[model samples]
Target: MENITFNHIYTLGNIVFENEIYKHYHYPEMLVRYDSNFLAFKKMPSIDEFKAAFTYLRNYHMKHGQSHVKFTFPENQKPPEGFLEYLNDNDFLYGYNELYEIQPDQFPRLKDNPDININPVTAENLDAFLTLQYTFDEEYGEEFAKQKVALHNRNFKDEQIMQVLAYYRGLPAGSVDIIISEDTAEIDQLSVLDTMQRKGIGGRLQKFVMDHFPQKTIILVADGNDTPREMYQKQNYQYVGFKYECIKVFE
Candidate 1:
């Protein structure tokens, strides 16, 4: 098998993003996902080009009813000189995300529980899946929750996305959505209820998915400042790289 490269990961990530966003603009210097109000550069550009890119993105998004927008620069790509200064001068909120990947051999196997069952979500249990998904979004505020609801409404029908649900002793405990590409499996939106955390539910759900794609590389992105990154580290996921993001949410 060929070794998985960052470029492969980058391309797959954009595929996933495009599906969720629905519309996009692919420019030589950057790719923009419209409905999500997001953009990312393939590589750094000259200061004049960078400024023009920003102006183009802002104008396009604003015309489309998105007042606020976000841009991400992958660590694998060179950051243009003065990129940070530009963000600061514009008063954009900034953050980073850690990208992790793993192979089957490195996947951890947790103790099996006869009481726990993880299964692919089907139409029969679709409502149950939505309940947990919406519950997970509650903390993020109503607007975020609404956005998630809309995303999932579209995502559930996408053939590339595999939805899994975990039941603990006959009750829904957690769920995950895996985005499948030709050679890689990217886990998107893995969530476990607060009351279900630390009971091995999350690990079992992850392992269940890993078992399905033994020959493919698994990928996920974690917030650089979040505890989930620590949990992923414990699962033996390699930190390949990260991307810094600049976001401005219009009031």
Candidate 2:
């Protein structure tokens, strides 16, 4: 696996500000996506600097009708001394994400399943794809789901993106979006229905990517504290790096 830094991670947003310290990304179209609207540090800041930065982010997001503030640290760096304690004292929810990558051949052979079928999203299956995604997005709210569906519709027209849905017994059970680049394909937003868990739907969806992108490295970011990272390790994905991030939501 290559040195998969934050550059390999894709987001649907534009950078609104930048300095030696950090960059601010804002996507007014999707306020629900915290990943698309936040600050990313280029290096660690002192607690006083962090307080000022958080204040700035909090005000910026509030002015835009957002209810949260988020910040991501540079990859492969541990939090500066007292940073986690500062976040904890300030009521921010914090965690890190583990980046994993596997070459096509590195992926182990998965058991063949006759009942599960995977297909790329096309005009014929676009509605099914959107419906399945909306089910997952609706947890935030109906308006957020509608906005996400609109975003997905826009993504469908982009040549660099491929969205796929997994079917079990002819019903949409899971889906994932593949962001294509010259030498890598990153899997984003991989999801399976609550009723469909533990039936290998997620693995089948991943296998679909591995088979289709045999020449490119397949990459994904898993919650470092979550069980899925363990599964990724068991599936032979190499853990490349991690980044610490935290978010605070206001009422």
TM-scores, each model vs. reference: 0.82, 0.97
Which of the numbered candidates is closest to the native, going by highest lDDT? 2
Candidate 2 local lDDT, 126-154, one digit each (tens)? 99999999999999889889999989999
| RMSD values, in order shown | 5.2, 1.2
List runs of model 2 lying over 4 Å from the truth.
Answer: none
Give the range of the ten consecutive residues with the poorest summed lDDT in model 2: 1-10
- Error (Å) of candidate 2 at residue 57 is 1.4
